[model samples]
Target: MIRTKIISTWTILLVCGAQAGILESPNYYHDYAPTFHHYHPQPRPQPHYIHCTPEVHNVIEVIPPPVIVRVVEKRRQTAKDLLDLICRALTDMGGIASEDNPEIGARIIAKLNIEKDTATLIYAEWKDGVNYRSRRFKRQAAGEDRVKNELGDLLTKAGDVIESDKEKLSPAAQDKIDSRHERAVDDCQADVCKSHAAKRNRIKEAKAARKG
Candidate 1:
């Protein structure tokens, strides 16, 4: 009975010792318990682009339209223009007038007044260096119609020459020659006449050749 009691006491002490060892061990539940760990998210990397390269494209050229130019014709001058030019020329040269003559004749003289716009034409008959009869006519120096027409009429009435028909020798008198001096009186005069005859002959030959 003592042996049985000692065995019971030994068994109780073994159980207590086993319980104390389990409480004192540091890794008793190391594998069986849930584990916690601190985790940080990492950022994703971005792709790199080429920014230094230049882009290329096709270029088109545009042309503008051409500009046009117009030209005008110049006007032609007439006989009236010539007359006006003459009048202005005479006016610039102060004025012009005819001189008296000893021979019996009619004369016409033109005078431009100080105003330069009016012109006067004088018609006169002269005998023995004296003016026998006189007439005065006036007209404008320049214009489109009246001046030109009036000047033309005055010019016609003035006539081209101042000599009279009476002073002119008759055909019978001109034809009549002195028999005493029929030929040239000097050798120099005869040579001059020969030269003039030769010149006339050369001109006639040239004209005949051209006509042929």
Candidate 2:
């Protein structure tokens, strides 16, 4: 009986030891179930509310310089050049520059009237040469009103061409042309008279010789 009782005690102690070994085991208890934790799902981050305006990446306003258009240059002309142009305009009007000048004085000289914006035009030939008048001496003065009027027309035409107006010529301009025409005609007549006097003197000398 005592042996059976001892065997029963030993069997109970062995069962208890086996249970304790299973609970304290590193591989089964510690490694498998270290800590029992409850995991609750976290809410996602809400995006920050921003203003409607788009963000400017660059500090300076990124705009290219405005396209600059170049202006066209206008033609430049001087007053004297304008007068020469007017002379050309005159030639186109079927008027000879100087009637007395078969070819002597074709060129002109110009004076400016700044107050009236007018040009005084005269042929170069009129100003030269001297005049000697005696009772028998007669020199035709250069005063061709017809040529003056034609020059006036030319001046008017040129004015219209430049300013698109017929009132372009001032009174001063007309006076200048008139005076020039008169001078040119007088010079031509004087030269003619001188030639005639030379011929008359030669004839008189021949007549006296014949009488002697």
Candidate 3:
């Protein structure tokens, strides 16, 4: 019985010694302990919005107006006016020489109006002879008016042509065309009378010779 009791005491002390050793060891409690983990929350997605507006349009119109035009007529020159211009042109020409003034008279001496029924335009011209040959352009009024004379019409046409062309010439050229030194008039009637007298004398001489 004492041996069994001693053996029991020894077994109890061994068990206590093993328990204390386990407590004092370094890795013994750590190896048998439970583990813990921690986590943080993440941010949520944001809400989105979009705004819209309407489109607008505009329209316009254009217009135009009408136009008008008018024309006017020109008046004709009268006989009296034409005759005055002719007279002025004749006065400007100083003498009568065909070479100096070939288109018209060399010189217009004078215009005579007799009793308002007859008109004579006397001008100097060069004929076949060496000297100036005097001539006349006479016209009787168709009725009572001297302005209706045919000579006036002829002269007026010539004056108009000259006047129109004068615009194209130099002033000096125009002056030369219009004027010359004054000269004497060689009358056509004196020449005609002289010829008649000479013819009569020849006829008398022939009659005398026939009788002999």
Candidate 4:
């Protein structure tokens, strides 16, 4: 009976020791009941960019300047110069305009007036047609000094070309040369008249056409 009691006590002590060891163990729960562990890797950190460079594109354009030129005009000649030119032209044409000439038959009819850049001469002549027709001459030439020089040269040339010494002869000997010069002056006047008349007629006709 005693041996049976001893065996029972020893069994009870063994049971208590096993229960304390389980409570004091570090991995008691894991050792008691093992579970599955699902490990998930952490996401890697992403890099940040500042994007300091701008996308804007600006274009600049430059324009060129303009060029300018200046022009100068010539001065107009004086009226006195024009008047002198007319006298010079008449002299060049070998017609005498001397108011002092005693021989009135050799004198040309001249009307002197001041014009632009030159002188004006109005010459009248009697043309013998069915009756005596009157005509006017317009003489155009340069300035005073130029006209005088040109006319003098022309007169000298005329005297040489005609080969007649009228000034050295008596009045009877100079009759032909003097008459010829007078007739030339008269013819020149007649021509001027015809031209002026034609111009007047043309101008009148143009006016009539414009009116029409």
lDDT of each: 0.35, 0.40, 0.39, 0.39
Question: What value does the lDDT take at residue 86 in candidate 1?
Answer: 34
TM-score top scorer = 3
Q: What does candidate 4's lDDT look like per residue over 1-212, in tens digits?
A: 99999999998888667656655555443233342223222334456987544543344466767766777764543333333444554343233323233243133222111211122221111111112232322212222334433332332233333333235444553554445433333232223423544664699799999999
lDDT of 3 by residue, 151-179 (tens): 34344233333455444455664556443
Q: Tell me the deviation in Å of residue 76 in model 1.
A: 5.0
Off by over 4 Å in 2: 1-54, 58-78, 91-154, 157-212
lDDT of 1 by residue, 24-54 (tens): 5553522222422222223334569966534
Ranking of candidates on TM-score, top first: 3, 1, 2, 4
Question: What C-alpha lDDT, on a 0 to 100 scale, does residue 74 get in candidate 4?
Answer: 45
lDDT of 1: 0.35
Model 1 root-mean-square deviation: 34.6
Give RMSD to native, each candidate.
34.6, 31.5, 40.5, 32.4
Given candidate 2, what's the lDDT at residue 55?
48
Error of 3 at 145 (Å): 9.4
Model 3 lDDT-worst window of ten: 180-189
Please state the error at residue 154 of candidate 3 in Å: 4.5
The regions of model 1 sitting more than 4 angstroms off are 1-143, 160-212
**Model 4 misplaced regions, further than 4 Å:** 1-75, 95-105, 109-212
- Work out candidate 4's RMSD over C-alphas: 32.4
